[model samples]
Target: MIGTSISRWSMTYFAMALAWLLAALVMMVAGIGYPAADLATPNTLVLVHVVCIGWLSLAMCGALFQFVPVLVAKPLFSEKWELPALALLSAGLVLLLAGFLSLGGRLPPALWLLPLGAVMLVGGFGLVVVDLGLTAWLRPAGPARFVLVGLASLCATAAFGAVFAFALAGCAGSAGEVILAEGIPLHAVAGLGGWLTLTAMGVSYRLLAMFMLSPDVDDQQSRWTLAAGAFAVAVTVAGGALAVGFASGLNVVLSISAILGLASAVLYGRDISGMFRLRKRRHLELNMRMATLSFASLAGTGLLGIALVSIDAFTEQIGAFAFLAIFGWLSGLVLAKLYKIVAFLTWLETYGPVMGRAPTPRVQDLVAEGRATKWFVIYYAAVWIGTVTLLIAEPNTFRIAAVAMIVGVVGIAREIVRIRRLADVAGPQRLPIGTVMPHLLYANP
Candidate 1:
């Protein structure tokens, strides 16, 4: 039995998120965003929000809507409401991009769009937080604990983002200027560190174990890792507030948060490694294998961040760090898992009802991992190439690498859509052409 109910809206969210990702990638190819333009410019801001809010945030929230119920063993407070939240988020993102364009002279001065879009975003996020937050709180066990902290971080991220919007719109006067100057880092910290990274970790903890047939990550270790991460986000948000409000003690608080965050990363690395070492499955699947690459990228982000901060060159190197964090670590991990998640969910939805009376394909039968693996390899390789090119100030090389990345994304997208359509699975062969063979006609892997 598929133990948890399927989230009807999740696939819709994933589709929109992937569309945004493709749009952003196209922008990269056209040299419209960062690495192509100045980092703080309006064009770059547009691209950043496209990737962050439209793609990453949507995808993560969608996954949470589906999985949080599984983790907490409860139905969503209201599954019907998720579609409205997605709509609000989508509309808000459009307005946010329009506001950014207005600043770039691409749109006629719609400065009000900044706060207006932010308000919509806040509402969208608030709905999600309330729904999932209530569920996680009702049953704070295992990954649910990590998810709860992550939801809190989402609130902080949205709040900071809203303040930034109002400030940039010139509503807060000098205070607005101060927030723009000092709060950007905090906004990033809460959004990336707390909402995205922490939540990804929490979700992955349960997912990796389930997919690999491994024992859950040790409860004690999981607690320590998430606790430290949660505290780091808490401190970072606190630091942002002080900086915005009192303009004092911000640095000290950030330093402490940095230490806590590093500790969390270290502990998390240890825990995940142990999970791999102890797994009952001797041969890891493609998604797990791809996740290893993302985990490596995360470690690289940590090392690079430390090196930059220690030398006080973090500001100069911020673009490269953001690139690695967004594309390599976050995007890579999400795409890798979606390959499995979409298929698994499809299998459950399609086959779970008649599991025993009629023959049904294995979830693996829904995927063609060998074909998809090369796309993953291409994507990650392109990400590194793009990251290095950006670090070295080689925009031309980065653009070329972006083209390669597009090709990779398109290939992966095709595979995902094929699975969704059930385009390949049929007949007495039992499995799809790309899957295992009992019949003489199936393709060899």
Candidate 2:
């Protein structure tokens, strides 16, 4: 599972993502976003884009940079570009958020920021897509295939986002106007459902199997999950495009999309359960145990999503549903996996060379699982609390829950930092004073 080479820029990506996540949480706790402002306003869009693009996108990209290589059993096409990609993305996000503030009349006239930032974002994401797409093409099997599908979704999401930004900046004609009026839901579906969810499903299939010592799940159930999920996203995009152009026959089309997505979610859940049933590890680790809760969140989101879409209340309830899917499902899964991935990568970097010559610590030895469980408990509890407050229209209570959730995030983040610093490696397993720690520039011999 840890057989592949570690990514050089992944730690940088992780650090930036954590910073964005913390920033978003702080902004929420300060009443900049939902619970403090209306969901459709610029204030809330700031938080949504921050979480979706800045936090979730960065974190997922970091994971894929490392594991996509593993999934395909090939080297990354251009690892050198990763840092530049991050730079462009970070700068672009700052400008985009600024533009959003300008749009809200919270800043001076700066409409130019919108289109410029969107261009940079598109450029940044495009480089990574090209790199990973080439790598997957070389050996697209198993989870890499699913990742490939997710990359396509990423393309569509970015396209829709670009159109929306141009419309906001008054740089586009009727086409961009249509996107501004009718394309936000399409963008959300392409992003949250297609890119994020599909990529998560693909990578998680491998990660869960690897961590649990379960047999590889590239079988029929897994294939069906990918097919249905990909088609659901494709249909959503097509239907959304039709609505943007013609604005007719979308309810039926979206219903079809919703049904396909629901089916995919169910099948994916079944795949996860099957993985657990067949695991050879026997004992579940802390990350794996927490993943069960994340899975439950996914199930709840799918069911709730169908009801909302069926009753034509999705837009009305988007706030609460997005909260559940984003924080509870996607964020939860990313955090849980980060727990294992950071430790594993650290173990490889620190212990691999001296494995035979020294009594190095096992990957698990580097983790203080007991220390992290409480933080996870706090995190999920806060998520539900925040979700309930939103449903009940209790902004103040939601802010309170946001405070608790941020504490959980900060605690978990501290744990990750500790692991990176080798704080838990003790006794006979401790390294000598002169041992050279791994650096981004260090190449494996």
In terms of lDDT, which candidate is strongest?
2
For residues 1-445, could you state the per-residue lDDT of candidate 1 as single tens digits? 2767878788878888989998999999898978889988999999999999888999998889889998888898888788899989999999989999998999999999999999999999999999999989989988889888888899988887888888889987897778788887788889888999999999999898889888998899899999999889988887657766887747787888889998998999999999999999989999999999999999998998899999998889889999999999999999998888887877776666567756777888878888999999999999999989988889999999999898888888899888876666767534433333221111111
lDDT of 1 at 289: 97
How accurate locally, in lDDT, is each candidate? 0.86, 0.87
Q: What is the lDDT of candidate 1?
A: 0.86
For model 1, what is the alpha-carbon lDDT of residue 302?
90
Q: After superposition, how far is residue 318 of candidate 1 from its true place, in Å?
A: 1.0
TM-scores of the models, in the given order?
0.94, 0.96
Worst 10 residues of 1 by lDDT: 436-445
* Model 2 worst lDDT window (10 residues): 436-445
